[model samples]
Target: MNLALWIAAGLLAAVALAGGITKTFVPKEKLARANGGGWTATASVGFVKTLGVLEILAAVGLILPAVLGIAPALVPVTAVCWVLLMIGAMITHLRHNEAKFIVLNLFYLALAAFVAWGRLGPEPF
Candidate 1:
């Protein structure tokens, strides 16, 4: 279970980190174009960048605390945050009628939830 949690956390962190880097650095117009003028089309650049920064922070929070043995409780907290983020993403995608993105968001949500449950219940660190 410990290994499973670590793997899930690592995978989620990698995805969040990659997404954060892209959303943080990529221009809104290009991001919209890349997504077929989807959510980014309606969102402001500042809002999009803010989400990116949040994702980056969540990614770091997922790993660093546990690895450093400092405030390891933050691992579950970060997972909870990721779960919330995915819920928001699902809502946004639903509003836009983007079923595909919602499915992807569900996948991420499930992974985050697993990590949260594992860390909070069975695996302390």
Candidate 2:
């Protein structure tokens, strides 16, 4: 991988890994409070756990294929999936009027787009 691809991949890996860890282990009460704090939501733990799992899966799909040189196709697929995931996050936060998390979602969307675009063409140095 060239500098651009490597950087994009690294960013995706970092974000997904961090978010996954956060969702997987963050305390339920704390997470619920941080999750916009309303609506008597009992299933937040489930959402967080599910998000963690998907993030981990996306992380693997993002790089393992390119590294192994077996199914490079997975790289772009993973990038697109992450972009969609972030878009969903953006919409969700917007609906909830959570400005803070919405901003974070935007960052993820941009980064995911960068990864998707960067991975498409030749590896740039």
Candidate 3:
């Protein structure tokens, strides 16, 4: 269970880091164009960037606190945050009728929820 939680957290961190970097640095218009006017098309640039920063912070919180043995409780908290973020992503994708993105969001949400459940229940670091 511990190994599973670590793997899930690591994968989630990698995905969040990549997404954060892209959303933080890429222009919103370009992102929208690339996605064929998906949710990014309707979202404000500031909102998008803020979400990216939050993702980056969540990724860090998922790993660093547990690894450093400092406030390890934050790992589960971050996982919970990721779950919420993915829920929001799913809602936004659904609003845009983007079925594919919603699937991906669901996948991420599952991983985040698994991490949260494990850390908070049987696999505390």
Candidate 4:
């Protein structure tokens, strides 16, 4: 369990950092291709940027508490929140005909769910 959590935390941190960096640097036009719906809505740039910020924060929350053994509960909370957000992202992709991103969203969502379950779900032999 410890190993799983640590690996997941690393993945989470790397993913968040990479995404945050991308959002912070990439031009909006380029983002459109990687994003859902080809970034049709003008608000998408802001939306994704904000989401990136949130993800980075959540990733930090997941690692800081547990890694430092300060407040471990926060890790599960962050995972839960990330799962919810990914669900919303999946919906957004479907609504916008951005099928490409849906798979990646689902992958992230599943990974988040795994983290949540590993942290909070019942033990299974």
Tell me each candidate's TM-score. 0.98, 0.81, 0.97, 0.80
Return the lDDT, model 2, position 15: 81
Candidate 2 displacement at residue 38 in angstroms: 7.2
Q: Top model by lDDT, which number? A: 1
Q: What lDDT does the true structure give each of the candidates?
A: 0.94, 0.77, 0.94, 0.76
**Which runs of model 1 end up more than 4 angstroms from their true locations?**
none
Ranking 3 against 4 by lDDT, winner: 3
Q: Among all windows of ten consecutive residues in candidate 1, which has the lowest summed lDDT?
A: 116-125
Candidate 3 per-residue lDDT over residues 1-125, each given as its tens digit: 78989999999999999999889999999999999999999999999999999989988999999999999999999999999999999999899999999999999999999999999998777
lDDT of 4 by residue, 25-77 (tens): 67666776565425434546777678778877877986888767788888888
Q: Provide the lDDT at 4 for model 3.
A: 88
Residue ranges of candidate 2 with Cα displaced over 4 Å? 34-43
Could you give the candidate ranking by TM-score, starting with the highest? 1, 3, 2, 4
Give lDDT: candidate 1, residue 8: 96
Tens digit per residue, CA lDDT, model 2, 1-125: 56667777877888898878777887767766775573114556777688888998888887788888878878877889999998888777776677888888788788777877777766422
Q: How many pairs in model 4 have backbone atoms within 3 A of each other, for residues 3 or more apart or on separate chains, i.e. clashes? A: 0
Q: Which scores greater on TM-score, model 2 or model 4?
A: 2
